[model samples]
Target chain A: MATKKPKIRTMEELASAIAVSRPTLSRFFQDPESVRPATAEKIRQGLAHVDYVPNFFATRMNRRASGLVGVIVPLLTDPFFASLLQTVELAALEMDFTVITQCSHGSAELEANAVERLLSMNTEGVVVAPLGEYGSADALRQLGRSLPIVFVDSRPAEPYTTIDFVGTDNEQSIGLITDYLCRTGAPPVYLGMPRLNSNGLERESAYRRWMAGHDLRPEVLPDDLAPQSWAFETYAYQTMDALFGQGLYVDATILCANDRLAMGALQAAHRHGLFNSRPGARTRVRIAGHDDHPLSRFMTPALTTVAQDIDTIGMTAMSLLASRIRSGKPGEETVERTFPAALKIRESA
Target chain B: MATKKPKIRTMEELASAIAVSRPTLSRFFQDPESVRPATAEKIRQGLAHVDYVPNFFATRMNRRASGLVGVIVPLLTDPFFASLLQTVELAALEMDFTVITQCSHGSAELEANAVERLLSMNTEGVVVAPLGEYGSADALRQLGRSLPIVFVDSRPAEPYTTIDFVGTDNEQSIGLITDYLCRTGAPPVYLGMPRLNSNGLERESAYRRWMAGHDLRPEVLPDDLAPQSWAFETYAYQTMDALFGQGLYVDATILCANDRLAMGALQAAHRHGLFNSRPGARTRVRIAGHDDHPLSRFMTPALTTVAQDIDTIGMTAMSLLASRIRSGKPGEETVERTFPAALKIRESA
Candidate 1:
């Protein structure tokens, strides 16, 4: 019969068994350098006799800062966020930092929990694309005070005193697309989500401002009529289907807030026998969107949209955070960086 | 003017100033529980006078394991992986575990590097969707020896002893779709990636077996002619274009390896003026795919494909990992779990 080994429950027990003081054993766990060489060797031998695994969370609390960087995105299911995360991870790796990503699933409570967890782990810094209007502003503000944080893609509903931000020039991008639509065809009606985040609000505002300047009426799907989910494609599809049934936008062009919405709306149009064609082909409907997502080009009649400089945004945010981390300064002035978005002309528009 | 304060450089200096032994000061830094309450208070007060951020990565070396659970996927930009990641993350959260995801970017070197980093972090466990034949099998096998690892989606080319796996039943799924396609139209030709991973190879083999059972010729894109990149959509699009240019399969229906590839092929067909309709309709061709990706339903004419039970796969992988972790037995017999796939008949086929 095999003999059973004894289970050591705590570090204190193991320390006592080795005839070393508990503090000396604890010191060995923190860093072998902190303890004398002979004492460290004894602790190592003591560990060999027992199955003891230290509580990592509790260990983290005693440490100052980890090399880990936390990245929080609103939704991992969104290709935009997915692409952005890939870029951020690659950049972090280049700078010798390992990134850990968390998805909020578009909930304030979950976002708060993610932040709390990151803080508890003693993360050195964070790059977050916040949940915006739906996020817990208080938790984020509190976190900003303790660690180096850089906000990307969308800013928070409530501003932080010294947090840096990196994002696309949504106003310019939306206005440029709107102007092109007007010049080539009928002014496009805006179709988008509710005020979910700063990006959504800014894009809507930019569309309204551009339409007003061009003397064109701005039409949008009312809040009550829009779908109430983070699944933008499904929402756009359902919204467009309902609109088509009601004979709304019979001869109008539509500009979606993002490429996902456009994909869904385009599918709805195709299902309704509205084949997309070139600008002068007298197609039933003309559709365009922002954010030239990866699949946008693969869509039938290819989607015409604006492409944000995702690489630049990710690199800039990382560079800014790296400076802050190196300087060990959390009291630096806020820096705002914006990358330009370019128009991608394809078959749809 | 603010007075210049003396900088306490090392832990030894702070220990002397606080009237505590250096080992006791280190003990407080490891875990407060290791030192007496009185000694911990003195160390805390001493820390107030200095800006000392301990090197956390070095400290982690002394600990046995971290609270972190690693999730490795082939690519983050793929919506299929994104959705799977979301499901796994939610499940992990339900079990009170936080997940950190890493993308391998479809490179074996990067995959190896990711596994190495996760091991260095002393992660509790890992759920990985490997890059099939392209992954670093040795690295994964080495990792399996130290931790509880559950392979999800695509398995590694070289199997390790006692490694658990959870995935979709690709053989049954391919046969079901192929039978449906054959009954509805002409025998579909196999369009897919090179044998990059088990999923691709298994799918291709299944397609061949199904075709052979029906006394039909097996048709696949020659290996030398296939695209080399992991961008499946681009590969499909380019392959279809090149094939069309060569005047191959003028009236034949295409059975794509996955939805992403099908989307690309469909786009290529559309560009080539081959609008897909019902099998008997007067359209240029029909196309069907597997793995009903999220965007497949929103495609023009929607996609005809098979839906893998992603939720079940994710949930099962997590559950299996949780059990292995609780048991603390890395030498357990290997377990393989496969979930059935359902055929979703849409307009394309």
Candidate 2:
């Protein structure tokens, strides 16, 4: 008798009959730049026809020995930091690695302590939006040497020394805001936290330079940034009220240090009976902020601020950390990648 | 030869110089309460006078083994949580044990994930301010048998079986507020979360009970509990505006669910120009809230609120966890502790 033909199966029948190898069609899930465009398109269209179910865990594990990423942020209360933290968290989840986060909250000792704790836990690699201060640099380098440590949003004093840094160009971002205010209205008032304490020095210096280049006057308002400070929102509100009481004629636009201060300023304006929808309510004064906090879009008339590329920051950080972790590179060759910022024109501006 | 030469230090001399450890000093330093009040006072005074430093770490190590206490909260953005977290952190720091805090952000998966992560990190005990749902008593117990777990501010199902719990007496607190409103003016209209959420149920029920007992009309206004999910503040504000426009008699005391809702109500009132500063302002409606947030006192005509004993919650949680870690006794009975709330009478009331 003729040997019973081993049940003849076409490629479609074989792919549909067994669920294991469908995920091996990487050309299906990935984009054209990653795989051929025509091939990717064919696989994509064919996936629905064949009822493919990719083994995500298996493919991820096979692709890499293991996927583990660590993310660190300065503080969660600050809306900017919170937004950034949330973005990175979502991105890491998409990549299918368990992202563990720690908040340093702007304390050197606490930052160091968190770093040590993360190190003791043996995370695959770390992405730190660190408190850019003196003591943190050495600790960061040590951690970088041991495993991949990608710094985000802030960097150390010594650049091109060690580790990888990803951040928005602070000078360019603030300069754009100042230039917008000057164009739309009068010279803007720069309201910010104390200059000596943080990386805001870059923004403050940029603002001063921008004003000088435009041949305009600059009014800088710096809040005292003591350690373990009091309420920043209240501080901003009270400061603005005091300035107004002193007959300081702030121009139409106020460029805030960040969204937190701007929100506070809006609240202050409300309390002072400004910004109401009364007849002829529009004043020369306008409130502009930065970072586009989650609540910003919900605020009255929304907020006009600089939007940072959080997706890029997250992806770059992950890639840098993964490479360093795999290579175990101890050599000090720090990278500072600066991303441009875009002006998010909204009602406030 | 030294003994023969009488090379000895006198207690009087030592006490005068280092200013500690005489007849009763040792007991006071070891445990302050063990000594008589007068003796303890004298020891403290003498110690302060001499400016002596104790070997705190050595003393701590000698007294007990290293104990790990865990703290978990729903969100870190709310300053109420931040304030409580800080207190717990300080308490843990003083107790000389590590504290691992995880933010669940109202996610069950994240909550369980944090618990598992803490257990994997070998936490000795845990104190959780749970999201009031989806906590597994069995799995939590199985993961860390030796460690004592304490629930704070929210109780899980089967409390006596798995862990100790602590929170404020919500019913009595709300009842007191209700009584105060009825006694002073018209019966209060309860402004509460739209959803009958688990944690605030007691407060709502208490308000209802008080209203029924007094034979007063209970007008409960429902509000969006998940403020972040919707345009909550704005919705609440506009709803109140419409209520006013329809000649609604809202001139009675309004008891808000929490400080945040009260804040929105206050903004609405201000926008409508309802609140006044004249003697007639006394006749205007009053508003009060619970959970005295830091910003509560800063609001115009500072808010009247019930201040829960958050410090006690933290301290008790730490102590229970420490005890559980040290004993490692699965046979140990579970416990529950509730703290009283205090009504802070402020301007808005």
Candidate 3:
């Protein structure tokens, strides 16, 4: 018969069993580097031998900052946000913090509920990709008063004027994609995104501005998607399919607000007998998009789009939140960091 | 002029201000349904008017369950896992438990670290999509002994034989895809996934077994991708690109382990001057894959694959974990729930 092992339940008992002073054990838990690595290794091996885990409840009871942070995004099913959250988690781990993630699923009520969850978790700080105009200002202001917060990807309007933000410059990105299309083929017609988010409104205005700068007439397509809908693909497919019988985008290029829309446009084009960008056979309907989504490169004709720097955005937001937590203050002067987007020219445009 | 309101910082103060007994306020926080709707409304309004959140640490300090659950996955960047996690989070939210997510990013070491992090969080329970053969068995055993754990999507070998699991029935799913291809065209050649996890190994064996059942020779292409690399797209592209001049899969249908691989195969096929499944200019290479991934429908020659019911898998896993947690026992006779995969036929095969 196997012998029942003696259970070590507390840190003090483990320290005593391992023949180390309690303060040494405490310091090692606080920062392993505070003790020699040999001692640290001994502690680690001892921990492996027993089921004893350092109690996190003690940290919370002491009214000390829990080494927990938070992140809120609109949807995790969208590959773009999924990839961004992955990057943010990697950065958080490197900074020795754990991240609690929430997906609002594109609902204002859910977004507010997520804020309450963060408050309950006692998160040291948070990074939010706000749902633009649909977000609850009261909930956000309450949260802002309590903890360090940084916004990423999408911007919220005033009186969040002093909030820290990290994102791609839509004006520069839209201008770059628009200019590339004009140089390569017909001046692109703008296939706009849903008007719920700031990016949708900003990108359309940027496209018009770029066309104005070039002294050309901008044919703005319908911004007809319903409010708060994240289904960009369905919207683009429906819009393009409805217009296929009339002109098929040959007279004007189709520049989508994002790569997902371009993917949908490609699908509609394929269904309507507009072939691919193969060497021998190709479609005359040149299309472009922004945000170089993960599946963009796998598209049949591939997508020509602007690429946002997710690594910089994720790491910067984390580092900013880290500094704020370290300073132990709320409502610091706001800072903004904008990254320029780079054009990726593929077969489509 | 707006008058400055007195701050009601504690639960007792808020209860007094709202003219509710302390027990009523506590009951409302515990379960709003325990109180009258009108009383619940009053409490909700009071919470909204003030920045007072029920302290989670109080529950922890009482040595009560924290009402926090955890989820561990191999990668969130993979859309399959992203979609599955999204479903799991929804179920968790419905159960009124907050979820903390950890992505191991396909590393066994990271998976172990995540287990340790969960231990520190004192999670009531956790649902893990284990990293098949690459998972940390000791860490998992420790976790299993400490709390309720349910594995999803991938299976781990014994001494975990009795652990609760939810996944697609691989044998049935593989047979369906293989039978479809054999019926429609030349018997397919299997493009294997990297041998890092159980799904990869199980899928290949399932294909071989199905071929044996049909009395046909199984031609499994090399499972040559390096260990622990999640770059399935690049792997499939390189494999297909290398074999381009050697016949271009015309003699045999190319059946990939999953949709992402099939997507890559399609891209390589397109790059090699082979056209798409758009009406007239179709290529002779017929490709099929498993796992009707979210983007599988948008693939140029949209994928024909097996659809695992993620909603059933996710909800089943959560409910199992919830029961286990409610029972307050570390180990019980484990249960396994397997859902049959349905065939989603598209243009690819």
Candidate 4:
């Protein structure tokens, strides 16, 4: 016996059967709120009858803007950025915006290209974590004039008066951690990144200022030995290994730039037979870091760090961008907001 | 003196300046290969003279297909998926394809929504790490009929003959790690997840099979203790802590389903004063895991794990999808490719 094949329905037929114009049907699928409730209901009912799915490309062609937002980050593999992205995604979804995230892989060129791509898409807005020193100011400025942009985590070195910025209070966070490290143990030497982003520079300055305020000598590991790549753990591991090999900073506290660096230092200390306990005979080194990475708690001795309120950051950035998108004004005065960080003391320090 | 405003050029002006149609200019921005070399070069020179970026939405409206490929994963915060995503993105870029990645957050509904969004974007193809048992087969089947799909890490429960799949050889990997653990120390207790994905189920089965082959009783951790959330580390930490409080397996080795769980177990052991070294008086617990997460090497004892060849998986998946897209055949026979996992023996075991 022969079986009958299912009938295929075209989008035009579906729209006609639903008794609505093609543009209205397209608008309904793009966003239900776009079409009138009665027409949207008719389209929905018709959609259930036919196995036809609207072609997104064709629907987007009719619309002036796709209800899409672009989020560009310096790196996605970093737990800090990963957590931040998650928070932002949830927030964007709640605001009825679809987010398309892209990673720059720590390259300035890639960052610029990402912006260009987002611009091409006619994205409603963009939330970016700029590659501080390496980012292109001209490209950002040009793009900023065309759409709403919110800079998160770190702002561009050459600030544009029209761009919104959201980030943690790095100076205050660093001061809090440094004060704790000094009071609980020996004064710490600053181990910092190679100025990859503005946050590192702020933290380094804060560490120096705090040490000098306490009438102590300021010590920072030189940048000559810093790794040129974004693998901060490897850089910290090698730096600590070389420093330990020279019998430097034994029984001294070290304030790492971030949790990943602190993790590597802890590993280096463990390999050197140095215990990381606070009150033990085997204890040899004290360590603290900034940016309470998600995995910090799982570290062997746990880690002492400053926790950035990522939820607040994500919420603030989204709110600012949504407002800008609604206003659609490019000449508005820029707003910069900073959330304070909290200290999380654990066994490491 | 007031600054002189820069002249704004439109797509029409640029096209006329380059002596080409607007459609050709749009095609050049979408993909350079779509236009003849000489015309593309002429358009590039015209673009260099003007500070204009093509409207991607408008350009996409004219094209039959967007050069965008969708990549969907069960979770984005997990380092395993992050690593796999990085590999896939780089490979896709090499193939001149733009990648749009979305995370399902381990929810089948979210997975279906993600596929719907991709369909709306008119994505050329999709590489998905499905949500396993919870995923909607009907939604995937509908998407499969429209474009090529390559499943990564795990395949769907209701298999379709036209879809391609690429993943790690779970049985071989688990067997290799289990044999090493048994040979080196006490036969390890199996620590498994709540069967969120097929990988966990396969690892659990492989552990039981190996134990039976050795004529030993297999011990699998009960799933009742597993957390309902995707936080594997917390789940493992709580499970290990509870078992330790009961004085169960005080000195026995453990084989975790994945590295995140192993990390949690390691942290719990440290809290209980059980060291993780091969040749030390303080050594008490020996633990191993699978899927060598990026941070696993930075662990104090350096995790011993089965390293899934994520690069191979990404490359194979992309290659298969690209070929399928080129062929444009939904009725073609499915292809299944498995890359062998390597046992990385480190200090933990």
Candidate 5:
């Protein structure tokens, strides 16, 4: 026969068994700070004696801060955004903050809707990686009027407002990648979008200029997908396949628009059965991209990409937004802080 | 020279262009239903004529419901949870509801905190995938007392008076997997935690019983990591590697505890080069698991997993909770709804 475990009846019985009060026990559950240190100790001892465990949700209401920080991203399926958002969540946990995340699916209306919902909650503040499209800008500007909203990844063109901007220097960052590719080998095909308001426009322009400076002809792919519908792999895979069918010739190297697109390029290359490393590394086709997403390391042969400083971005954005929340006055100084990106040399390139 | 686009100022100017009053224009943006049919048309024309867009947050404020539904999960780093939560968000959007997602990190305190925050926002309701061990049952129950709270994936022993629940049929679903493995191949080595919650315990028990019924001895490799740590992959990888190194060979198949752990096992098997398919029609060391996570399809050779009926579960839970919300009464029946799991036969057994 199995031994039966005894059950606890009341707080008093449990307290008496360990040797502490009903009030103190309640206080400990409600707010840990509400009870005296000595009383808390006695209650802890009593709890062990009776083996009484309080209910899960009940103890939470007994505490404070609600532990929720609202996080809004452009999309969740995008590995780049997912990696950065995961980092922010980890940082929030370290600060004892629970994160409530939402993806706008690149819709300005949805972004605003997500924000309004977050505001309804007892969110300390919001860390938003917004879509730089015109609609989202206006929506963000409106949100800036109320809460301590921190803008991440996307940079709003309005230079007068003091919304904290934490992101990489897209132009300079991509320029470095372009320069390296041009210097090490023949200039690779530049894969990017064709939009003016897009922050990536700066990167594309930088690549063109860098190529021209090196006296190399630039081959830019034209893409018209809306920012909301733009997926890295889908674009890259189709475009690369098209390039292959068109009998486009390459110098055994490719520079992708982003890490996701690069991953797609790798898959395309693999489909062509071109993965063997030649003696002296001559037969290896080099592929590189930007934003070293967390999963980049796990990809086949890994990825040689540029890494963004998201830690500094998240922390600075939060602190800046917190100050604005406390001031009650909208900020005037537009401090556009840009974190430098570094090249990560891996198996791919 | 490029033609310059004209910009108009003031709502009245835009309204006049489309033959509408400023008040109607304002009302249209606030709530499209507030105006007459003709008036709404005129206002939309006014908006399009000058491209005048109203503030989303301010406009939504005029509505009765915020259209915000809170979604709380344990963490975002786990791809499986990330994918599940993403699906929930899509479903909520299809119902014209915005989602606010919070991560509990499998902590009871954090779960409670997220609930309090959601309440402070006066959210319509919350769908939570809680950490069963985290002592959040009471906090959730308290919320259930006043608000619509739906439990997803995890359920407390003591059901909430008003809260609704949606989850997979752990016992029956896992039993199906165990039965299949036992019939077709040698009883697999049970790899998982010694003591587990609903899903884990159900899968473990099914394995044990299936082995016993088939007149075979069960080999258990219980993980030593604490449940709260949320380190499923690390431990599974290390354990599988250790077993492989020790020359521990049993049946021709490996049954993983879950899809996530199965993913780790697959990676380990690949690393050791023992997971290759045979040339003939013979099954090559079958590997099967539960939970058809999103990544399961994309894996090399795919995966043979148990598919949970996510759509039915989500919709049922929402409808049940919504009824409770409308009636202003707690649900009478404690519904323990269990959906069957279907086997997805892929390359990996």
Candidate 6:
């Protein structure tokens, strides 16, 4: 917004400047015929006196075909998001849609700003993986009133009941891994990720439920390092190092919430000389994770994890949003589309 | 874009329908006052009959403050690019600019399409990491003529001399690592990455220069596995596996083009049972690389590499773009801004 400041700063001021009601002016912008001809004309005349980009808003409001969709993610570094965005982009391209992308980088304030930015661009719909725990519900609810939005990855906590969600069924996936670990070896000791969103809690709860079902005690590790941090690798590495200071796990089986944390746990094991032996060295630690990361197989001891099917999640999110966009309304009933995660057997566990 | 199809399809047909020339219609849309009042009125009347979204273009053309800058990169899978995008995004936010992002996914056609998408959004400026060898020069040149464009990570060859570039000084950084390898151990056998961009060739040349300076013959490996693929790890893994099949390298030291490649090479070594020994085991193969990737430090024995200041490159690119945007003109003289890379010695080498 490098343009010179308008003498009238806000829409309230502009509405007052023209002696027209704010709602009426807003209505005129949305569609000139929605307001009386005299009111619409007054709003137009007022617009002529301002340097603000109301005309841009006016143009967006008048269009029936914006040919654009916005995609907002917490961060691109998460391999999973990177893959999701790529899949969505290809799907968008096929539908003759241009994707405008913004990363919130896990900041709630920035996430809100990203929504505002997308609104200003007049995106027809949005597919966003919101900052689950830290998000502002009001901002998102406000957006839901005007445009169709499809949530990917972790759906935020309640009060977001109206938004469609497409993600891994954490219950089934985490349970699958937990079952596999128990069947093949000692029951797993749960290693958690930062409570960035619902996934952290959802995944851990699944592990605890499985343990309880099996009549075994769940060893859920307390976060001793960077709690609530997205730096999964560093967090896991440091937390694992501290755990080693106490002693090795009695079960010698670890199940991390995600593959990234597993990667770090392995690195820490290597640092503490636990990885010096072959993975099958009987007493060596067996670690597994979830969300088969792109590099999981390439890890020192290839990671054993659950695959979340990002392609399905991404394509499904687009399909759901497109239907809403085509209908030109937010759906009457929001739906949750969950996919199962498959167990990927690798060297680590 | 989902609106009822208009009776008139193409703009050319619309121009003929309205009994006006195409260029005149284009000029009118760019600025209605640029054409005769009657002609503009006729064009507006014709538009009322169509479902096309011409007003969106008109609004962008009429504005001095789009408040938007675009970023197009080849892919987000690369840790370096991921870090770079994050930096630029934060910098863009600081400037009160919203960023529109697109990924080329290493396709020249897609890169061109990304440019078109940004143009239609009427971005004030752009920071792009182009598909170096395969990029569409004409598309980028056209964009450069209209708005300031800053290149990051890699600069394309001829016909792109006009765009400002910010990247690592590969010669200094590559040479620094080469010297360290030579002084501490045997001269390194060069392992090249896919020549996806300029950095690929530049780093290799720098390595060659350092070897020549020391009066040693450089052994650049043949790209037997993946010549131009972006899947760096798999490529290096397969290539190194083939090399290992031919017996171990005589030098016993490997200098990879980037840390990702080194990672793959390391995995291949482990697969071949060469990585099972301790680093101090004199006969153990030594591996080093460039571009200290985010995960380089956590590699089994850790990776020794060079660091490109992504924070500086990203911030500098934004500053250059801001100045050009402020001047309302692409600078008359294009300049290359390169930062020297620092050596990050870890256990691998």
- Using all chains and alpha carbons, the TM-scores for the candidates as numbered come to 0.83, 0.68, 0.89, 0.91, 0.70, 0.82
| Model 6, C-alpha of A83: deviation from truth (Å) | 1.4
Candidate 6 per-residue lDDT over residues B124-171, each given as its tens digit? 999988787545776776678667999988976544656699999998
Residue-by-residue lDDT tens digits, candidate 2, A1-349: 1342223123344345434244435433332356566656665665545422332222232232335566777665565565566566656665655565666666777777767656544466788887766767666665665567777887654454555778888888888888887788767888775332334677777888889888888778844542234256676787777766564633257888777677666666655655555565355468888766545554444578888777677677666666666676633577668787889887777
Q: How do all the candidates rank in terms of TM-score, highest first?
A: 4, 3, 1, 6, 5, 2
Best by TM-score: 4
Give the C-alpha interface root-mean-square deviation per candidate. Answer: 5.9, 11.8, 1.4, 1.6, 8.2, 6.8
| Predicted complex 3: DockQ | 0.66
Model 6 stretches astray by more than 4 angstroms: A1-61, A223-226, A277-282, B1-61, B223-226, B278-282
Q: Per-prediction count of colliding residue pairs? A: 0, 2, 0, 2, 15, 0
Ranking by DockQ: 4, 3, 1, 6, 5, 2
DockQ, computed on Cα atoms, for candidate 1: 0.30
Candidate 3 vs 6: which has more TM-score: 3
Residues B184-233, candidate 1: write the lDDT tens digits.
88889889775667888889989999899989998987446564577888
DockQ of the candidate models in sequence: 0.30, 0.04, 0.66, 0.69, 0.10, 0.16
Give one digit per residue, the lDDT tens place, for model 2 in B1-349. 0122211123355355645556555456557898878777877666554423342221222233434456777766565666677677767767877666666766667777777656544456788776655455444544445356777777654345455777788887888777877787877888775331245667788788888888876778754443432233455566666765664645668898777667767766765556754454456868888888665665665789898888887787777777776676733686778887788888777
Candidate 2 CAPRI classification by DockQ: incorrect
Q: What is the C-alpha lDDT of each candidate?
A: 0.81, 0.64, 0.82, 0.82, 0.66, 0.82
Instruction: Name the lDDT of candidate 5.
Output: 0.66
CA shift of B141, model 5, Å: 3.8
| Model 6 agreement with the true structure over A1-349: per-residue lDDT tens digits | 2454356545678788788888887777667898888877777887776743443444354466677899999998778888899889889888888788888888888788777767756689999897885456656765786689998998764456576999999999999999998899888999988888888888888888989988999878764523668899998888888887676662289999899999889988887777665555677788999999888888888899999999989999998899899998795788889999999999999
lDDT of 5 by residue, A10-75 (tens): 556655565555666666877767888877777766555453445322344323343456778877
Error of 4 at A80 (Å): 0.9
Give the clashing pairs for model 3: none
lDDT of 5 by residue, B71-151 (tens): 787777666566667677777777777676777766778778777767654466788776775377667765675467778
| Candidate 6 docking band | incorrect
Which docking class does model 1 fall in? acceptable
The best candidate by DockQ is 4
